[model samples]
Target: MVSKRLFQSVAEQIAELIDEGAYPPGTRLPGERELAEKLGVSRVTIREAEIALQAVGRLEIKTGSGVYVSERKPASLGALPQASAFEVTEARLMIEAESAALAAHNITDEAIDELETLVNQMSSDDEGVANAADERFHLTIAQASNNAAMVHTIQSLWQMREQIPEVKATYEAVCVHDAKSRTDEHRAIFDALRARDPGAARQAMREHFQRLLESMLEATERKALEEVQLRASQSRERFLAAAKFG
Candidate 1:
């Protein structure tokens, strides 16, 4: 069974495609069965995704007819940077590692405690709660850097993470398979910060993203391989967009 947020990710993917003109305004989307097969998800997930897109005015669903892309684009789409998951991850690795190092030196005991709480919260069964806590955990460390510029930069990266459909989908897919690894990595970084070890903190943060990047590659390759016999070009193109990092 998929998490509640999986359909949101699917909705984002459809919206992104519409925005990119793959499905132009007024273009009818494929049937739920086709989309489900293409995305390797349940038909119920496709239905939920379409309903979500319709609710956001990105699509129009007719009772007898099919879902069509809306001509009216979302206002916030233009504000988000056009970046792939790999680019976003790469940026986070470079910027956040330094932020973690600085945070190790500057973080207060209370902030450390807060991070510990967030780390524990990440182990929650509720995906929404765990995801929110994960964001807070990183932001707390970024804030601990005591550098406004660093904090702003980290915030922007996270905005890219959350707002970009492909990035968000890729992350959700990888995260679903590695929740334990993610929590352990966060703990390592938290431990480094608590010890006030800048070098260790930097290394821990780097290791976290490094593992994330590697996992993304593995997931992308695996999915592409699974779908290649059916839609080799399309599957490869989609996964490659998310797996561009070294």
Candidate 2:
């Protein structure tokens, strides 16, 4: 019998294949029997693997048709540098505080106008549009800093958030919890920058990340509690079964 973990391993392998363009977007995946034969796993295991990928928005299942790769692929699920949401937020606090301070000194009227536009877009009710605008707003600040290296560094960090599945998952969960607060935080940062107050900008940036760190800790604790409860329930079920058998 294949272990439960094997299902996840198989899912990761399939995700790698998708990442490598072996199965491009909108392409139909091979049947479960074919995948089982190719991977030396049972059909049931293949089904579980497909389910895992589907959960992350990597695959689309069409009833009466077939499984196809989703147009929007998820972050690579394979082995990659995994950073906790807190660590990413911590790194942002360090780097972005300085970026915001520099932007306050070097930002032009044109950049401020652009930032205002992005902030308005971020306040929209649409999550996707708001999220994209949020990213652009930060990158715009990096650009205003007039440091090519800082721009490159900040862009690289954002790309990592997109490419690492665990980080993306954690951040998505956090976003869902308190997204409205982020708009207010961005506004505070913008206000400090517009006033050309470097110290205020830096403080605002740091406070934004401090809130994120607190949220991450709360989410982590809640997840741990859920897992503990699940394990306890499983143990109780096993005990009852064994008692009945004895």
Best by TM-score: 2
Tens-digit lDDT track of model 2 for 114-144: 7888788777887655766777678778878
140: Cα error in model 2, Å? 0.4
Model 1 stretches with alpha carbons more than 4 Å out:
1-78, 232-246
Clashes of each: 0, 0
Report the C-alpha displacement of residue 201, candidate 2, in angstroms. 0.6
lDDT of 1 by residue, 1-246 (tens): 735578788888887888787899988999989999988887757866775565446776543356788777643433677899999999999999999999999988888887998899889997766776787688778878988678767867876787678999999999999999999999999999999999999999999999999999999899888787669777888899879862
Weakest 10 consecutive residues of candidate 1 by summed lDDT: 55-64
- lDDT of all predictions: 0.83, 0.80
Q: Candidate 2: deviation at residue 35, Å?
A: 38
Model 1, TM vs. native:
0.64
Cα shift from native, residue 207, model 2 (Å): 0.7
